[model samples]
Target: MVSERAAQVLVASNRGPVTYAFREDGTLDARRGGGGLVSGLSAIGTDADALWVCAALGDGDREAVRRGVAEPGVRMLDIDATVHADAYNGIANSVLWFVHHMLYQTPLEPVFDAQFRRQWDAYRTYNRAFADALAAESAPGAVVMIQDYHLALAPGMLRELRPDLRIGHFSHTPWAPPEYFRMLPDDVAEELVRGMLGADRLGFLTWRWASAFMQCAGNVAEDGRIVSSAPDDPRPRIRHSPTGESAFRTTLVGVHGLGAEAGFLRRRSHELDVEERMVALRDQVGGEGDRKTIVRVDRTELSKNIVRGLLAFRTLLDERPEWRERVVHVAFAYPSRQDLPVYRDYTAEVARLSEEINAQYGTPGWTPVVLHVKDDFARSLAAYRIADVALVNPIRDGMNLVAKEIPVVSDAGCALVLSREAGAYEELGDEAIVVNPYDVTGTAAALHQALTMPDGERAERTKRLAAAATALPPQQWFLEQLHALEALGEGGEEADDLGRT
Candidate 1:
């Protein structure tokens, strides 16, 4: 029923498509994982001549790897626990994530000492494990698609091992500007850029991030200038030499704004469980009277700007006392990366702030702030259905799918209060209430406007916003990249001739 292809597609990332959990009886249960990357892969189907290589994160995963019981289309690599921790918790999450999100405290934080160097070594070793596994499993002339900041160096490592393979790297996080990126150790910063340059195609979620990457490359490249096609080109081929001794390669860079699966969301939102949750949420927000709901669903990640969102809600109550009990802020702040102490502290701060807001503005019959910190997809969908105003004010984000998703699932047309810093702004800015993420007063005013928007106006904007958000569905987003890579391989000069002599 399927045609055979010589070149297979290999996907490398920190986490794979499915995760395994072992029961007490020594039986393992495999569950489909969550994330934009996994969602995109599902678009390609299971029989696309594709193999996924990823790290085993938990004991269950490690045990599964030990038993050679990987999923149908996935391969899990179990590295030493210590090495994985240092590489993941240390370099990737602690260092790179902070840099890209611009979350470091600067003078008080990020002291890269001798211990950091050791962790950097572990990071390299961790990437090498992925490179080794991908190299071993890939078919001849396979197209390898690597994901995110966790495996930055793997592309170069894999290229060195197998020059014939076609490589593409996609960044799911914001690319730090040249100034902030230069904060890394000189050699390390250059290595990161050079490592990614090994890929034949590099994709970013937005043109702003793509420009930031090109600026960083220009700063680190040998000649201090990367040649490009045109200023308005969507996908441009740029040439850069990693070092004076290295030959220049023409690496193509493009923007692919990942979108939500509208069909999936529409179907899932109507499930019985979701409807039950919707009723519960309506009771929580509406109490005895029908109060407008300002909803935000986010993980307790620092860059999410949850604290500021709550503060703005407080500001709204202070500045506009007439709207006190008429509106409720329903926040679903889910737990994420709790293993990191910084994340734990941020989550605690979020709780404290939410409690403070509730204490400040509480009536006998209505609560101003209703906060939930657990992960519940159904509850989120329920909130989406009842929300009058959706607040997605991330300080910085790759795509912030929540901004796009809320409009798709809303019942009676929701108004979006979006952040200019979010990648979604590039597409949905014209329809949503755009706010500067740092300005509490501006966000408060924007929230007030969103709440008071005329029903007809809100409905029209929601229609346009939903259309823009789903312009490139996850399936189409992924297949477009694959097709672009395939075309590059077919039309370009030999891979060997492009990079080195």
Candidate 2:
């Protein structure tokens, strides 16, 4: 049933654990990638017998592929440039991402026609490249874990290639409900669900998303109907056709809320670089005296709701005159996906809003908003440390780790004002001042509440939030999924047993 020579585990995702950059001297510089997935894999330790397969995203990566360069435990696949662009920028980001996040205007957009079909074909080819690479690298009975919406089709594609391998697919984004998911063409919706059903175990960030997935599958599956034997049970079993034959021998669906590495954050928050930046930030926010600092650190992505966050801050100033000179909003709006026109426009809007607020309520001693548009991790950690309140209001997110990270690293307890729509709300809602992402006035009220929160109450809530955020660290998170996949290879009952953990 097993081969000693085969790799014990394989991780597949759009981006790898490490990325290569070309230096002026034409030499490759390897830098570790950043994300929850990378952090989880790193927690598994270098001793684990695992291979990570990822696509070459840039020219440096393509050149590295040409040179046949390999990282310690990584395999890079060089797909055609045009196909990769269409699949990633066109279909994945522009189409699928918009659909899942429910970000479309509905009436004017999502016009899927001949061009969409071409991009969809390229998307298929892109997934095929990854499936072929994973199939080639995997050993007999190896457990393969595919990550995120980018590779939604890989599980089914890989299953067709290697039935012996135990496959699991984890969705890092929130799954759209059946009604919204039906926006896809009939055939495309069915194919997407069937692709994911190829996995032995399907994992999501929350049970809500898992239920949504089951609903979508039920609506799309012509021959299959999903039935929950127990109403209260979070897990749903799908039974296909009149024969009652289950597809893929029972796909175990589960919820694993990804969290930040508290141990790492605790240690890194006090480093010299972070300390230096923290001092500068304190001086910037509290120029003359101690003023309350409301900090928001996010990429300038549309879903992050950065412009609305700025608007809420403006509303706070207009409604509550006392906070005009006593509070400062330090917004670190880092640039992300600059090549995309929509992202560029969003970034410009954030800048415009921040300037409008500052121009409207400017004093020599206090500026309403201090915005930074660059990538600086140390600076972000610095902001986290000095933050009196951390604002995280994504419209729809898988799990906003920043919501968890701020509470863990804040020097003085920070009040968290989180969006109800964020996936993090499932875990941190009890302690956070939750606001509707679309309500600017409500969010402004929330900000005022957070800023005026009592010190003792804030400290107590921070402790509880930190405990819940890091309950299952990255190491345990990855291992739990691995263990579930391994158990599936053993038997259905064994997988269910592991799932209970």
Candidate 3:
């Protein structure tokens, strides 16, 4: 049981540990949180007092929520459906999201207006709900950790209620540079910057992202100073928590472990309609059996560089005739943000390229490319299990866990063709075939090399990959943060009371 006397650490984010679903009978079902959420929280262990407070996704969430089973000190606050719709579906996902990912079209340009303001109000309301909950729940001098861009305003909001609270906020996404961040209205940007500044410590995934945040702070702050920096160097005193799995296991079980989607992946993969998908692919490509199945799975987003990847595959088919009989690319691109015209257009282009490649190089026995547009995690895991080569080439990612996940779950000794730009390159680069995301010919050559690598070498690489992927599992990720928080608490008051600079 959590007591008021126990030291508390509250983690606030957009999504919580439980999601609600309405059944046929209209009763609600609550499911445990998946992916990074599970991993990070589990790592904290039982010794430390921690609570994960997150917004309820829907009205069903309140009915579905399993009161106390999720974890220690976990709380799910129910907000209005409109609050989530405008804040998450509107401002956060559609607007600020594209800004951070650099997914906007320069020709069309992004505009902020009354609609944005209304949505921004909802965003504020949602964040405040979490802030109010944390303020009430947190003990004096408690350490409050906020996660991701969705709750950027929560730190300050929480701080207002508990000035003595030791606060920290961590950004999981890539921070946009000053130029890209300037797209937001001046007041909105200022609010975001000041909101995050409420934290005593700020965390980012990489130094590059940290630098970007500092640059944005410089641009928006009144006196051109962030965290009391010199006028010429107006930057925040931010910390880089380049989270990773343990160096020993190659799995995310220990130091770097985020959490296991393995069971989820395995269970889900068994039922997904991949056989029908395989049949459709064969029919579309004219039943080609001798071709290589080069598989790529991603949400259809701008940063994924799906169009460029398809162009590279096309280049390979054009330049190398031998590959024509030996290669088939299976692209499982799930639709994301269809309401956004830019995303809709990008999805169309990906489909157009897939057709052109098949028409140009495909024969009755071999369709050079097969593209499936739907969200199917199980089919994706199944593909990972059998893929001879896995291509994950993102333009810029904080950490593409797929680069790590594929190699762990792959049954065969799969070769990884990764983008140099992906954050996972820091860990998997030694074993992966690195390529420039923009270079079509280069990526094709990498694909060829991955396909042709010696059997002994491939096995060696896979062994190393499996070791790396499981090294630091999800529990470790959470525990490390808790440990850091505890250390701060132990030393914080003494330093403060002493007035040590």
Where is the poorest 10-residue window by lDDT in model 2? 492-501
- For residue 137, model 3's alpha carbon misses the true position, in angstroms, by 2.0
lDDT of 2 by residue, 107-187 (tens): 898899999999999999999998988888888778899998899999989887888889999998889999999999998
Candidate 3's residue-wise lDDT over 26-117, tens digit each?
86666676777666766656676778888776667666454432434667777888888898878887877788878777788676778889
Candidate 1: tens digits of C-alpha lDDT, residues 345-431: 999999999989888898887889999998999999999999999999999998899999999999999999999999999999999
Looking at model 1, residue 103 earns an lDDT score of: 90
Flag regions of model 2 displaced more than 4 Å. Answer: 1-6, 225-231, 240-248, 490-501
The global Cα lDDT (0 to 1) of model 2 is 0.85
Instruction: State the lDDT at 407 in candidate 3.
Output: 73
Model 3 scores what on Cα lDDT?
0.71
For all candidates in order, the CA lDDT equals: 0.87, 0.85, 0.71
> What RMSD does each model have against the real structure?
3.0, 3.2, 7.2
Per-residue error (Å), model 2, residue 489 = 2.4
Error of 2 at 484 (Å): 0.5
